[model samples]
Each structure stands twice: as C-alpha cells, then as structure tokens.
Target: MTTRHSHAGTPNPLHSLIEPRALLEIAALPAGLPLLASAERGDGHPVLLLPGFLGDEGSLLALKYFLRNRGYDVQTWGLGRNLGFQTRHANALQQKIRFMHFKSGRKVSLVGWSLGGMFALYGAKAAPECVRNIITLGSPVSMGPEGSQSPPLVKAIYRLIAHPLGTHGHLAQPKARDLREQKRMPIPMSCLYSLSDGVVPPQEATIDGDPALHENIRVPGSHLGLAFNAVVLNIVADRLAQPEGDWHPYEPTGLTGRLYRLLTHKSLPL
Candidate 1:
C-alpha cells in the first residue's frame, strides 16, 4: 500500500516548531560579512525598508545600515510597528512614496520583509511612477495556485490584531487578487525566498508574472531571519545596482550561485 500526504494549504507545523532557527541565522550574520562587503555599492538613490507584521523600524536596522553603508539613502517604514497592513497605513505609505520621489528627484526603491513585502507591493502598485524597483524578502505573496495560504496560527493572530481573515487579506483584499493575477506592476521586482522558511512557504512568497518583470530568487535561511540573511543582502545589492531602464535577470554567483543552479525549480519565464 502507498501512503500519501494531503495539500492542506498551510505550512507544515514542524517548520513552525523550528522557527527558533531564525536566531541561529542572525547569530551567523558576521560569517558572511566578507562576501557581503564585496557586493556592488549603491548610487545614492533612496530605498525604503519595511518590516514584517508586528515589526517596527527597529527590525530593519541591520538592513538599513548595510544599504546605507553601501552608498544608498535608506529609510524605514515610520508608522511604528506594522500591526498588519490597513487602510491608514496604505494611505500613509502612498504619501511617503510621493515625498521620497519628489524630494530625491528620483524613483524610490522598496525593500520589504515578510508582511512588509505586502506593503511594498501595494505601494508600487499605487505609485509605480514614484517607485524604481521592488525587492521582497520571504513575503507571503499568494500566487495562482495558492489563495492566502496563511497558517492557522497566523490567521488567528492576524484576525485579532489586524483585519478579518476573509478571502485575501483585508489590507488589499479586493485589489489583492487583481494585484497578483492581473494588472501586474510595471516596476521591476525581485522576490527572495528561503526553502527553510517556516512562517510562509517559499511558493507563496514568489510572484507568477512576466518572466522579464518578475524574478523568484531563492536564498538560504529562515523566514524570520531573512532580513538578516547575508545571501539576501547580497542579492538586494546586486538588484539595486541595476541602472534604470537597463535591467536584466539576476545571475547568481559564488557558493550561493552554485546552490541556486542546483535548484530544480527552474525559475525561468513561462
């Protein structure tokens, strides 16, 4: 007899149990500093960083420092702790993007982690003109096959602190489906996910859009530690370094590149 597993539309509980590994990933950050230091520097462009649910500017300090040190002017989502995306936050972000674009006299790049990715996507869609490029780290962006595949525990917590867990999150429910399924943003986007992520599955974190416009790059680490992952920072550096109107696909290099080539996912365009 053959035993099979079922598709439960949720992340495995075991991954949740090991979420503590995020700490290990954070502790190991210094080990990758040498390689990270070699990444291409920025061009003094403005980049906004958004943290995940219940996270605040504090959660993105490491990323801000890394990007700022590389010559980019990095700023954090200043709306205090992200208590799950809501209407008020969305409006505020739209204003923020406009100001950043106007003040800098250049398009602003958005770099978001986890739920923060949701905010970034929303912002880009709202004001693509003000935005340059987008990079998401381990965010739960539902693709074609998945429809808000949030774990039960996450769902419960979200409903309590944020909006109701209806079809598509209340943050961008009506447009959320359209955001992924149709009306793709014109902005260049890169999604970095970890196979080891526990909070959100890798599939849910990537985009299923035009191959030229969207990329699903895989990194190694935990969901909680993605913001601190060196491989992630390197990819962000490489992606951000691309000159406007001269963008191309990310060519993985170094040990991480070797590991990326080994992946059978074949993230090429459809």
Candidate 2:
C-alpha cells in the first residue's frame, strides 16, 4: 500500500530535530575559515539587515561584515529582539525603513533572516518606493502556502512572551494591502532556504507564486546557520551587486554547480 502525501503547508517534525546543527555552525565560525571570495562587491547601495526571532543585531555581525567588506553600506535593525507581535510594531518598523530611505537618498535593500524576513516582506509591501529589493534567509514568510514554520518550542515561547507584551496573535497579522502587495511583490525578491534547516521546512521558507519577481535559491546549511553560511553569503553578495531596476534571478554556477543542482529541490519559477 502507498502512503498519502501531506499538504504543501504541513509541518515537518523530523526537520525540527536537526536544529542543533546550527549550534555547530556557530561554533565553527571562530575557526577563521574563509567564507567569502575577494571578487564579490556591492554597488554601494544601503542594505538593512534584520535578525531572526529572539535575535538581535549581534547575531548578524558576520553577515554585516561580509557585506561591508564587499562595499555595501549595511545597517542593522535597531529593534532589540524579534518578538513576533506587539502593538505599533508595524508602524515602528515602517518608520525605521523610511528613515533609512530618506537618509540614504535612495531605495534601500532589506536582508532578513527567519522572522525578520517576514518584516522585510511587509516593509517592501508597505513602502515599495523606499525598498529596492529583498533577500530572506530561512525566514518562513506567511505569504507562501505555509505560514509559520516555527517548531513547538518556538511557538510555545512566542505565545508566552507575546501575550503579555500585547503584541501577540492579531498584532502580527499583516494588513490586507500588505498581504496583497507581497503576493505580487513590486520589488525584486530572493528567498534562500536550506533543506537541513531545523527551525523551518524549506517549502515554508520560499515564495509560492509569481515566478518572475521572486527567486528561490536552495543552499546547504541549517536554519539558524543561514546568516553565516558561505554559500548564502555568496548569493547575498551577488544579488546585492545588481544595479537598481536591473533585477534578475540567481543561478548557481562554478565548481559547485553540480552540487547545487544536485542539492536544490524545485527552486525554479513555475
């Protein structure tokens, strides 16, 4: 007898078990191993970095440094931690994005990890004029068929902290226009996901519709480790290097070409 397949949005408990690998990736960072090539460089545009749930700017230090070294003016999301929901949270985030756009005198790029990715998508939708593009790493954006890919522990913690803070359930919900714009995405967007991600399934981390404006890049790393993954960094650099209004999808090449082809699962546009 054949087993039935689960729906696209079904959660994967097995992937959740491997979350510990992220810790290993973090531990390896101190080894001083080279993670980026010298050839990579940005177009000097302002890029904002947002951390994952319960994460602060410190979690993205390596990524910021990598981008800075490549000539991109990178800024960190000043919000203390990613607590999912909270009153006026959406307004505050938009204010920050506007501030950056005004100060830079150009459309800014948003690079977010995990829940931060959701914010990035929201920001793009709320103010596409100020946003040039978006790049998400292991973020389970709700615009997809899947909602939150957070495991049981994370969900529990979110409920415990968010309820008291008044930023719980409903506050996190996107506005109707925010949802609609994200589905169409006026700005270019790139989603990077790893099958080995322990925090969320790969399917939940990628965009479901609109092939031309959205690109899903499959890389090798854990959900938590995506911020530090070499391949991820490379893709980030390449994407940021593109000139404004000249966006294009990413295609893995070079010595690792075969590996990328072998590892990626249905990343091309439909």
Candidate 3:
C-alpha cells in the first residue's frame, strides 16, 4: 500500500482559517518568481479545468493562463459557482467533454480541483472513451466525511445552500467511495495532494490502485493554492505532455527531486 501523510484523528480546527492565506499568496504572484519549466511542452492537447467548491472559473485564472502559455489548449468549466453537486451539472459537463472530444478528435484531459476533482472522477467514469487522463488536486474521493473536515458551521452553510439547489441527492451518491474498490481507472489518473491541506485531509484525497497507471504526487501548499503552486504547475505541465497511451511515473529531477524525497514521507516511487 502506498504511504499517505494524514492527521491521526481529527484535523486542527485552526487549519480552516489558513485557507484565506493561500489567496493572499496568489495575490502576490506578480511579485513572485515566474515558473520556467525545464520539461517538455504540451502537444497542444485539450485540457479542461474544474474549480473547487464555492469557486468559479475566475478562481483558476492563474493556472489556466500558465497552461495556455505552455502550449496546451485549456478550457474552464463554464458552469457557475460549484455549490456542491447536481445531476444537471454533471450532464452539462459530459456534454462539454464530448463536444471537445468531437471537435478536437482527441481524448480530453480532465483536471479537477477539490469538489471539482470529484466531478472529474465521475466524468472519467462516464466518458472514458473521450477522456485521456484524470487529475485531481486535494479532492476527498476516498475519505468523504473524514476528509471533508467540515466543522459544524461550515456544514450548516452547505446544507442551507445545497437544499434549495436540489443537489443533495446527487451529492449523496457514494460513487466516490466506490472508486476506492476499483483496481484502476479506465483512463490514466493522477492524484496531487498537499500534506497541509486545511479543507480536506491529505491521506484521504487519493485512491490506492494500479501503480502503473495511477500516481500520487505530494505537493506542498494549501489546497486552495494548488492551482497556482509552482511545483504543482510544473507537475501538471509534465504530466500533460506525456505521449498518450505511453505512461510512466513522474521522476522529479534536481532541486525539485530532493524536495520530493525530503518532504514526502514514503519510499521513493523509483
């Protein structure tokens, strides 16, 4: 079994407050170091990005611009704010994927963040033929309740918003839990997690299955800032550029390689 870094019992309540700090960090991007990748560029494939709960397309602007600059044709989940779940949202998303696949005549890659990550899993399950790969950032696809880390106040807000939207039934589905039992996804999958994630527990973010096609990348940052994290961005670019149907585990090199081994608490995949 792959070793996962997780809080032993309940997570610290204070961690939830730390989420806003990630936004502040992102606000400082203009003054921060620009990411210059030493890896291969994308082949101009189509990539779809999904935002987390309470987030919209604007939330992923930085990541979207970065990928666009790197050569991949990126599209945002044009749907409005991600409240929680709804069958209609899923249906519309499937249509979007199929349309892209049809137009490009190529399998589209799904990159979902947080709750959006859960959407990506369902998307891949629903349209494996149209999806080349699925990547999730800090999504609680495994440890639903445990990983959610939703305090009483937060839970209340979710209920109030989800009830009127009639998304509770859809969100109630146990498909995410079912993902854990599967040996592997029909499409290639990547799970990127942050050990210090405040919204979701890190350990429960990824699923354990076929090592060859399934990869768990441990990045360092808040779950909210994953889309803008330099390390995470580099990893995304590298994974997206891989030759389709010819997959391999990511092997970080140079200073990044050293950081991976030092911060990640497990035997190196190599």
Candidate 4:
C-alpha cells in the first residue's frame, strides 16, 4: 500500500534539503576511514552486518568495530557490491547464514542497513531457525511503489539502469510476492531510522507488524551516518547484549540519547 502525502502539499522541505546532503555525506566518507580502521572481535552469539545499496562489506567497518569491542562475533556479507532486489541475492546470503550456524552451533543476529536490512529480514523469514534477532537501519520494508522518496532525476536514472539490466537486474522493482511473503512472518525485529535521513522518507523505514514483535527507534542523523553514528552504535550494542527470548525494545538514554533528542524532532518510519 502506498502512503498518501498531505494534499495541502508544497514539496516536502525536509526531502528537498536532505537529498543533496545525503550525496555530499557519501562523498566525504573517505575522510572517516581512520576511525573505522580498528576491527574488533567478540564472543557469545555471532552478528552479521549488511550494508546499504551500492555498499560493500567495507561500508560497515565502523559498526563492525564497535560491535566487536562490545562483545559479539561480528562479520560482513563478503558479497562485493549491492545491486538491488534479486532472487540470487537471497540465495547468497542464505548460504552465509547457514555456514555460520553450522560452524558456530548457535543462532546468529542480523544487523542490516538500507537494502541490506531487507535482505536480512528475508533471510530470517527463509530460515528463522538460524536467526536470533534482527535489526535494520533505514530500510524501506513497508513502503510500496510510491514509498521511494528519491528525486525524480535519481528515479529516472535508476529506471534507465534497470531497463538494460532487466527488472531483476541493477534497479529492479521489489516483487509483490516477496513483500507479501515477508509480511506473513514477523520475526523479532528492531528498525532504527533517522529523522534527518536524506534517502528514504522516515515513514517508509518502519515495520508494520505487531508492536510487541517489532520496535522502532528514532535517531538524529543522515542515512549514511547511521552505520557509524555513535548514538546508533550504542543502541545496537544494548540490543545485542540481551539474551534470546528476553529481548527488550531500545529506548535511547543517557547523554547521547539526550543530545540526539535535543537536536532532532522528526522521527523516521521504521
């Protein structure tokens, strides 16, 4: 179902402002390389991280580092680049989860960003026995056709790219059957979204399932920032620390939470 915008609409100011900033932030990411250089490994349950569109395992390096230091067996989807929604993509990730389960003899936790989050959710539904918990950063799981809030120019470019590659190619539209399948299964989930996200509209990022099974945490940052933002890192750390069947929703507390709350007012959809 598509979310209807307010009819008394002028263009959404936040949407206009954020799109360019998201591009700028992405370009400047190289400067933060040193901060994520130190990788840490942890014990207990294994955690796998999935990066956003056009992202690779390296995009999640900072989050991996922080989770490792806090104590979790963190790893990346050794997949080279994120192309878009495709059947083969799911197969590749399912293989990874199966391997981890076999080797560790324990269920793993999944943390994914943007497109990666959708894949993680898909993986969980396909093999729920292998996943203990699922967390997503600015993933558009609920939004249907009109949910993509990209600029017309960007949308046009993606359409052009998808045409040559075929619908299941680089920019294929999400399959309705897949979405319907996902909605049928409600895994323990947490969706972390940003009011300041420049990519997806906040509402699109939310999970429309039972509140008890799914929780939404709102933060202040850009879409790219969620991967490395200290505030987001703390929330992830707190959630992963809980034991299975005793999972609790994250309520951002302390100085960082306060700071984030003070700086932002808009909440993104999980």
In terms of lDDT, the best-performing candidate is: 1
Cα RMSD, model 3: 3.1
Q: What digit string (tens of lDDT, one per residue) describes model 2 on residues 1-270?
A: 111112354346766777677777777765523436533588788999988878888999989998998998899878888776443656677888899899989899999998788778777777888999999898765434233545667667777766642323543455633553455566778888776677766666776645556777778778878887666787788888878877777766664444456555444321
Score every model by TM-score.
Answer: 0.88, 0.84, 0.86, 0.79
State each model's CA lDDT, in order: 0.78, 0.71, 0.75, 0.68
Ranking by TM-score: 1, 3, 2, 4
Query: Looking at model 4, which ten-residue stretch has the lowest summed lDDT?
Result: 1-10
Which regions of candidate 1 deviate over 4 angstroms?
Answer: 1-8, 143-146, 164-178, 181-183, 254-270
Candidate 4 segments exceeding 4 Å error: 1-43, 145-147, 160-176, 265-270
lDDT of 3 by residue, 81-190 (tens): 99886667877888999999999999999999988988888778778899998888888666545334544555566668765423344445675445445426757788
Per-residue lDDT value at 149 in model 1: 68
- Compare candidates 2 and 4 on TM-score and give the better one: 2
Residue by residue across 163-268, what tens digits does model 4's lDDT show?
A: 3443224324454346534753656788787655666656667656666667777775777667866556666777777777776666555554455566555332
What TM-score should be assigned to candidate 1? Answer: 0.88
